[model samples]
Target: MATTTGTAAPELTGLPLLGSLLDLKNDSLGTFLRARRDHGDVVRISAGPPGLRATVYGVFSAEGAQQVLAGESANFRKDNAFYQEVRESFGNGLLTSQDEDYRRQRRLVQPLFTRRRVDGYAAAIATEVTTLAEEWRQADAGTVDVLQDMARLALRAVARILFGTDVDAAVEIVEKNFPDVGAYVLRRGYSPVNVPRDWPTPGNRRAAAVHRALYEVCDRIIAERRSSGAAPGDGQDLLSLLVEAESAEDGSFDATELREQVLVFLLAGHETTATSLGFALHLLALHPEERKRAHEEVDRVLAGRTPGAGDLDALPYVTRVLKEAMRLFPAAPVIGRRAVAATVVGGVAIPAGADVIVAPWVTHRHPDYWEDAERFDPDRFTPEAEAARPRYAWFPFGGGPRACIGQHFSMLESVIALAMLLQRYDLEAVDTVVPVASAITLQAAGPARCRLTPRNP
Candidate 1:
């Protein structure tokens, strides 16, 4: 155990009473970056007023991130206000579950996400990307919103993979309600004070309605699956595998647990990948040299054929492009955890019960670990380069026991989608400077419009 040097971490100065609340709300990413820039890697940020004030111990260095997320992860738990808000809105799925529940969920879901299993879904990903490529090729308007389009594609692909024959129903419900649900989670997650959810407040009411609808849809899907009599571990889709999963000691997820897991998969499965894909395309469009290199790589490896899991390794440059994009715009920019005990990270003492945040948004750009960090450079991810950096420096999918189970799945989907898209189109950025905000995920605050010209046209 590392001993604290009795030194207190520097605090970010903020306005009277509200502290950094307005700044955080208006520009969280900027505020975090500024915190790291003005102060050192470990800085204290306070928000809200006196009694209701929420103070976060912001860990901005790769070393600190490693300690909080992997080294001393037990000391840093997911019981923070942000996670509570997520659990209330999204249910205690693996993403929000803790301790024994998380352990059990991980054991059950881990087998379903093995490399071989995730690779099998590449066909589904290719199918969806190909479909979108065709739609883009045939569209009357040459320009499209990359973020919105990729979101649709990711949702459709994941839904199909998860639900198999029943994808249409799941996709429709998620597409319709997720935006609002995400908004609600973000609003309440950051707010210093929130009214009782039962108070019939507009936000509360809207959240409840969306939650009910989402739950009902998931429950209906599970019921249909059960009615079909699909045996455990026998069905092709993920939902079937989950439905059938069981343990002699732990048993399997009940209907409610199934619904929660499904909702979590739907939310996490699409959004993060969409953010990566959209940004990769946008970045490639802005940098023609990078785009051309990507196109060449895609053209060579794919040879005008659809990409699959095998091509993932074959197209290293394309993968790097996605990696670089993730570094610049990681989907989960700030990951929050509550400290269970007093701890020292990066030589700064963090007291027990502190709201600790390990921000990839800042760590990925940490000057000590990255040179020209803000620039989009895929070569930074070359095997040699990556091995040289601290493991947590570029952690877009997070770290520790709670790292994303869908890491492989997300990579496969992004690589396949990018390779296929690059193989089919010549991209140009119509909205060159895309404004972004940190919500539940990194979001495009403005339109990320790109002009797609068909390659063979």
Candidate 2:
């Protein structure tokens, strides 16, 4: 059923039955890098037993990525084993929806993330970041877990800017269960001995419970919005817009679909940003010189005020730092696609039904596009430097039409949070810790412990 092109692709073999699945699960980034280094751009990696077929073509070059993500995207679909993990945890939301379902959801959901709409959220984001800075300011000197703190901040910001009245309940549920939910999804995705989600395994039960709680929370929010008759512009929240936009028939999302969309926004919007922000601050804490430069830029730009979206352009250095952080450790490191038809990518044949992987983790560090690939250098994002590299070379937010819809929202939120935090607090790394690239997102295995000290303007 699955076959490569005329010239067979280099393949990475693993232990019998389990195959490369263990290698991938153990060290995904390392496994992908090793495959690319041993083979060329397109390498076939197989897992599972001899009788069963489970494979993914690891493509780690710009040209190869463009072919699958842009050039011949129609030949691929999100309905694949890779996204099956996401669907099991998140349901039939935009992230996992396929075909006409994806089309309709995208059409209805796209408007809420438009640049103008995202810009309107800047003030609230700035306020939330300022509030967080003030809270940390109270603890003049203390060590805090950067990832946990940032995750909380990102969740609060998303709740305020997107959901109106139900923000508190949503935040509580996510705070309590997101770690378990995210961990299960990521682990199950790469587990060779895949188990049905309904199976009463401990992990499965926990994930199921989290999903039920989240769904119930979403249902409550929807019900309140319906009873309150909140119109679009009445609350200017994402839920209100969906409620107002719904039609009797054709191109409208029903209650169930609406709940899925909200969870999508909450899960996707917050998780990726939180992970990236945690890494960004961690990187800055590690590099004092970069931290100083970021502080200098913030000082000069705002002089001493909270930052909003308008300040983003002026704080170019802060933006560059965030960009560079994502380049180094992208939140969604791998973009997984499945071949719906046999296709050729970078001159390598890809069999239909094969999982196609394009990782920013690999491409962002490709020697051809970067001078010092492993180094933490924000200057690489400078206008002139970035212009010199290939477009798909540093796609932290990904590429093509299916690229992350919350790119603008994420950027705005990160920039404001970074600026505000930098202006008011000095976060110094208290420990050397690298994040573990996991099934959901790249996350700190332990905690990103940092000493926080209030700074004077």
Candidate 3:
């Protein structure tokens, strides 16, 4: 971090403000690593909001990521300069809330995301994946958009598991509104002067309109479930639990609280998984051997028929492949923190109010911690190989107290989905995709075109 303490400085690219922002906007990871290599691990740049400066670190060491995540309160706050941009879209939900609000909501949702609880949903999750694969199989052979397919499938899975409903209408609502939330929050850091929430700008108004529509849909779902008395015959789903969740202080969650939780889980839980699964498939297709080996692992573990909860562990190869894919292309990609007080990380002074982003994409691929860095190697995730790697070398789902609560759920879904897909079909990328880095999750700059075909193994 460049400070006025007369400390020696390292070289940096771009000019002062524009360089960091340009590098970040263009290629997030590249800019950071390139900066780190030129300046140092702890480099300070004047980007982001006015009062908020950015301190970038290439924290590939697992211990570091763990510490940051575990020590979230001491070192960070989620509702920082950039996060405010997305608040209208996300509300005071778990993912975007700060301090005590985060803790309270996390408690309510914690029990539901337990490994055992998530395990119960494994079959259902895999069933959704299999169902989607079968749908793709039924489609005429040609360029299939894996990203779009996975997004819809993931949305439906969450809708069923969390909301206890088919995503039929939810899809239209999300398709129409999801972007509004992201665009409202993400594009150029938010400010009262420019991207004002109250402004009648077409974009802002559209985002606001979507916000109202989403809550309206959630209200209807809650009303329907309440009116029906949530009869026991239908399969168990997330909506049932949410509707039934017993609050710690209060007896139960109120309508307003439930609305935010549903939206949070619906978006946070599913969108990320979709991007990740799609990225996994994309990477697997590029490396045929990895794909074949992953397919073999699924075959050996599950053979024929559907994969169940217990089968997830038996499919470690599938897990490794998934982890390796996430390592290479983390869906969320970056985790940002705002320093609560003046502190030093790697001997750099982090001014209070500064925005510190620990970019997983840069750290995951850092040569300081990874060999080859760019190659697809599931072997790296083998227990022994992982033991040799730094703790933060991988943060696809992030780490620490504020880390993704739905990590277990997402992983199970991914492993089972990948196993089921590879066992029954083969896929390969079609045209080159221009990777786009936006949304709550990372997606192809353009839709990922792929040729999906039935596989025999």
- Best by the lDDT measure: 1
Global lDDT scores for all candidate models: 0.90, 0.82, 0.72
Could you arrange the candidates by TM-score from highest to lowest? 1, 2, 3
lDDT of 2: 0.82
Candidate 1 global TM-score: 0.98
lDDT string, candidate 1, 248-340, tens digits:
868999998999999999999999999999999999999999999999998887789988888889999999999999999999999999998
Query: Each model's TM-score, in the order given?
Result: 0.98, 0.94, 0.90
Between candidates 2 and 3, the TM-score winner: 2
By TM-score, the better pick of 1 and 2 is 1
Error of 2 at 388 (Å): 1.2
Q: How many clashes show up per model?
A: 1, 2, 16
Q: What digit string (tens of lDDT, one per residue) describes model 3 on residues 33-75?
A: 6766566666655445545544443433344455556654566
| Model 2 lDDT per residue over 78-99, tens place | 8675578878677788788977
Off by over 4 Å in 1: none
Q: Of models 1 and 3, which has the larger lDDT?
A: 1
